[model samples]
Target: MLSTMRSGVRRHSALLLFILGAVLLTPLSQAQQLQTKFGCNMTRDEDGEKVIYGDTGEFKLDGERIEALRWESALYRPTHGFECSIDTSDDPQAEVEQDGDKSNWRITLKDPVAARHQRGYDFYNHGMNCSIRLQRDGDKLHVIPSCPALCGSRGNFTELSVDLKTGECSYK
Candidate 1:
């Protein structure tokens, strides 16, 4: 009876150790496997579908389209558009290419850009026309973009997710 009790305690201790080790390593493994370069906030619409605000890209204020250089006197901008429930790809290599009326935007992460945006060790040029602020929260991101004063006026300063092609804002 004494031996049996001793064996049972040993087994329980082994199980407890296993659980503790797993809990400790889980976060490390998950962090290493994270591949998403989280961009812009995606919200749920009326139907609860995930979506990023697709802005007009034209950068307007008070219903008037401002020039590229006059984008600093503005206040209130909306440029986030990614929703967890509906956002598909967390591709680390998204980029934007101007194609016809809309843009062909792909959010890609090359080593050079990854270091600056992720680690903050390097610097990437903030195009005078627009500035994208990428805020990292653990494995997630709060992507925000602003129309700088270089665009002409204090332009649209919203951090809304804009459809690169249509520049349409998500109405949700």
Candidate 2:
């Protein structure tokens, strides 16, 4: 009889532990509802004309997790190292300035990923000096490196646009 009680107690304890572990390890998505995935569409503007700038991606941010959605295009510049974020607060304004130029827009995200330059940078005076731009309209946040200047005046100044709500990117 004692053996039977011991076995039952052991089984109950194991079941309790298993239930606790399962509850603790369950994914947050399974426990809670997830809103629509944050995304963006990127477009670009060049040479006084609007063009479908190819090869871009969108980023989704949940709390602190950021995921990049890449598009297949041979012309997209890889954004690897840079500092950008979306700030959505009482004041909805996002801007980044480079090469003595300033871009002001009205969309705020927490922290957006950095896109690499299509063409790298010129090493001058031991300081990184590059031309980039900021294109802003309504809920769109676009980042364009002042390219024509970087391309020895042979390339077009590209523009990057992002939808603030969905984090979509489109190169113009």
Candidate 3:
């Protein structure tokens, strides 16, 4: 009779432990919620290529994550990329004077992106690696991209800045 009680108690304890473990390990909606910080995501489909300016991707109401274009002919690279800066500034000369080392503005993209440049000449022939960063200043959003050796020259890294409020992106 005592052995029977001991066996039942052991079975109940095991069942309680299993229940406690299951409760602790459950996701409980944390896994299903959308990302709200820093704003980064990849495109789910190849639908943005249908248009010229590109389509919208994962973005927040504050525009932390704006629309990114991914359009590359499968024959070219079998991947998509951003072509230059989206909204070029009406005049880039003024911003050029303020350009400097933006090594700290590098951002790791969540999506595989491809970009093209129509410079006076494609000195490098191949696209250069770029580091894009975003900064909020008062009522403006600044998009900065740093490109090293764009023209294969020394001390001539191209740095660009885009004012989100005015939709003006210039070589800053």
lDDT of 2 by residue, 29-124 (tens): 232211222333344554655444343433332322323222222233343212222222212223322222222422232222111222333321
Those runs of model 2 whose alpha carbons end farther than 4 Å from true positions after fitting are 28-41, 46-51, 54-71, 74-172
The CA root-mean-square deviation of candidate 2, after full C-alpha superposition on the true structure, stands at 13.7
State the lDDT of candidate 1 residue by residue for 1-172, as single tens digits.
Answer: 9999999999999999999999986754333221222123334453454433322222211111111211112222244321111011111233333323222222222333333333232233433333443332332333354423122222334454334343333332
Best by TM-score: 2
- Please list the Cα RMSD from the true structure of every candidate, rounded to 1 decimal place: 17.3, 13.7, 16.1
Which model scores highest in lDDT? Answer: 2
Candidate 1 wrongly placed segments (more than 4 Å) = 37-172
The C-alpha lDDT values of all candidates are: 0.33, 0.37, 0.33
User: What TM-score should be assigned to candidate 2?
Assistant: 0.30
Q: For residues 22-98, could you state the per-residue lDDT of candidate 3 as single tens digits?
A: 88645422221221122112223235443222222121221222223221111111343333332221111111111
- For candidate 3, the 10 contiguous residues with the lowest summed lDDT are 89-98
Q: TM-score of each candidate?
A: 0.24, 0.30, 0.26
Judging by TM-score, tell me the better candidate of 1 and 2.
Answer: 2
Query: At residue 81, what lDDT does model 2 achieve?
Result: 17
